[model samples]
Target: MSQSTYTVQGMTCGHCVQSVTEEVGALSGVSHVEVDLPTGLVTITSDSDLSEADVRTAVTEAGYQLAS
Candidate 1:
């Protein structure tokens, strides 16, 4: 599996983490997702490397922004 960690912005609570987790976890080949609400860090475990655009879109869909 491949792992990638991204910092997200605008996450404030458990709901934020849930939203991010749901969206990112829906990605193809993603096996796991962990969201750290305090640090706005999202760790994704997947079968293959995910693209930035895909991750960005997923974050946006979850009502957040992926830190640049």
Candidate 2:
């Protein structure tokens, strides 16, 4: 499996974490998603490496943005 960590901005609560987790986890190859609220870190594990564009889209769909 491939794992990727991204820094997401605008996440401030459990609901934010849940939103990000749900959105990112919905990706086809994604196997797991973990969001650390305090640090705004999102870790994603998948069957293969996921494209940055896809991850960015998922984060946007969750109403957030990835740190640049």
Candidate 3:
């Protein structure tokens, strides 16, 4: 398995965490997703390493942005 952590901006509550988790978890090969609301950290585990573009798009679809 491959895992990566990303900082996401604009998440404020449990709903935000759920939204991000759902979106990112939907990506192909993604097996797990964990969000730390206080830290804006999202950790993703997958069958393979995920592309940044894919993660960015997922975050955007969840109504958030990935920290640059």
TM-score of each: 0.98, 0.98, 0.98
Best-first order by TM-score: 3, 2, 1
Model 1, 1-68: lDDT tens digits are: 99999999999989989999999999999999999888999999999999989999999999999998
Q: Candidate 1, which ten residues in sequence have the lowest lDDT sum?
A: 33-42
Cα lDDT of candidate 3 equals 0.98
Q: Report the poorest 10 consecutive residues by lDDT, candidate 2.
A: 27-36
lDDT of 1 at 28: 96
By lDDT, the best candidate is 3
Rank the candidate models, highest lDDT first. 3, 2, 1
lDDT (Cα atoms) of all candidates against the true structure:
0.96, 0.98, 0.98
lDDT for 22 in candidate 2 is 98
Residue clash pairs of candidate 3:
none
Least accurate stretch of 10 residues (summed lDDT) in model 3? 41-50
The sequence of per-residue lDDT tens digits that candidate 2 reaches over residues 1-68 is 99999999999999999999999999989999999999999999999999999999999999999999
Clashing pairs in 2: none
**Candidate 3 Cα outliers beyond 4 Å, as residue runs:** none
